[model samples]
Target: MLQINNINKAFGTTRVLQNISLELPKGETLAVLGRSGCGKTTLLKIIAGLLPADAGEILQNDQRQNELPPQRRNAVYLYQEALLFPHLNVWENIAFGLRLRKTPENELKNRVEALLVHLGLQAEARRMPQALSGGQKQRVAFGRAIIIEPQVLLLDEPFGALDPETRSQMQDFYQKTAEQLQLSAVFVTHDLKEALRMGTRWAYLDQGQLQTYPTREAFVRDPKTGIEQEIEFWKNV
Candidate 1:
């Protein structure tokens, strides 16, 4: 469980987040929809402990973690770019975190190899990141993040740079991977359809305020979310 209470953030005089609060249950994905620069990424960064919140309580599984650093938070932040190490092959990239912790070489190899097969990337184990396609690269990135078994996965517009077909494919992969691993995730996006498709729980963030819906139907029908218009527009098309 990830608990956020009265989270606040500001840059100089401008407030980025205003008393934001939300709870994320274990193994649940909360899809957040917001406009650019509306503090979506800021919220994720706060939870991941990459950025400090002016005021708030961050709890993980009933433990207080507000003062914990990013490394101690056991959270991973992933952005749109794969940002994979160009110098490392797929095998090394996935095992990178494990090796950082100095896991046994055989254990690291086994874990990395298992993740490779799980992500259907065993054929590309020896290939460099530049040799892979967009979807494949994102898969590698995902594998790298999950191999360390972080408690929370914070994804910031991860598929925004992909083509429509690739975006959909990656979305499917994300859903399957999270479910299979029982990973808790917070996915931030601007696209309505993508949010609806990817999240088990839906929330809309506008001007630093967060609102969640009881169901997808409610999410789409709620006037404040502006998702109803998108649904109607697609129906007409």
Candidate 2:
């Protein structure tokens, strides 16, 4: 399980996250939904160790993750953009992390090839990011993240760049992959429908605070929670 306790973060005088706390169990997916400037991305970054929290601690199981850097956390983060290496081909970009960790050539080849197949990117394995469609690039990014088999996965509007049709397909692919890997995922999105489709449980974030719902039905029926309010707000957008 990934546990976040009283996490607080600030950028100079601007406080982005305050007393944020969350817990995600293995094989469970949690969606973080909020309006712009609500600190959703900041929270995901802090958890992934990309940014330091001013207060509180993050833990995996019982191990302290306070001092661990992004690379040491075994927490993979997928940004809004695919962020693939401009100079590397699809296979190389997906194998980048493994290469950094000195994984054997045969092992790397097998793993990357398997992920390519799993993500339906086998035909594009040799293609450059520049040659792929928005949806395909996102798939490659997701494939790279999962190649490491991280204990926790953090997604920050990973599908925001794709069109509606592609976004829906990617959401389904992500859910299935997460289940297959039994990954604990924290996905950040402004789309309520996407959240409802992707997460087993939903967390509503407002002004840096997070409140979780046990299920989507509970979230939708109440229409009182921040998530429901945001959902209604976006319906007309």
Candidate 3:
């Protein structure tokens, strides 16, 4: 389980996160929705140990994670872009992390091969990043992240680069893959419909505050909750 307790972060004079708290169980996906500049990505980065919280604590399995660096933490972050290495072949790119850790040759080959099969990219294993489609590149990125078997997966608008048709396909693939891997995921997006479809429960963020709702229906129905207002705000942008 992942536990975030009263996380607070500030940059110079600007405060980005305030008293953010959340508990995520294994095998669950939580979607975070907010307007732009609401600090959703900052919060996700803090959880992934990429950014430090000015206050509060992040705990995994009841143990403090303050001492762990980003690479040491069992959390994977997928950015808005796939961020693949242009010079590396698909197989080499996916195996980069394992190689950095000095995994044996046989084990590395087995692992990369399995990921290629799982992501339906076995045929493109030797292709360069520029040769693959958007969805295929994103799949390779996902495979690289998941191959490490992280305890938490953080996605920051991972499908934003794809066209609508590809976006929908990738979303479905992500949902199924998360379930199959039994990974706890925190996905950040501004799209309400996407959040509702992908998340088991939804979190609403406004002005650096976080509130979770049990269901999308309940969240949309409550006028005073500001969820509808936030969605409208996103649409205008």
Candidates' lDDT values, in order? 0.91, 0.87, 0.89
What TM-score does candidate 1 get on C-alpha atoms?
0.97
Let me know the TM-score candidate 3 reaches against the reference structure.
0.92
Off by over 4 Å in 2: 222-237
lDDT digits (tens) for residues 79-138 of candidate 3: 989999999999999998899889999999999999899999999999999999999999
Quick one: RMSD of model 2? 2.4
Q: Which runs of model 1 end up more than 4 angstroms from their true locations? A: none
Worst window of 10 by summed lDDT in candidate 2? 222-231
TM-score of every prediction relative to native: 0.97, 0.92, 0.92
Model 2 TM: 0.92
- Output the number of the TM-score-best candidate: 1
Instruction: For residues 123-203, write the lDDT of model 1, one tens digit per residue.
Output: 999999999999999999999999999989999999999999999999999999888889999999999888988899999
* Tens-digit lDDT track of model 2 for 91-136: 9999998999999999999999988889888888899899999999
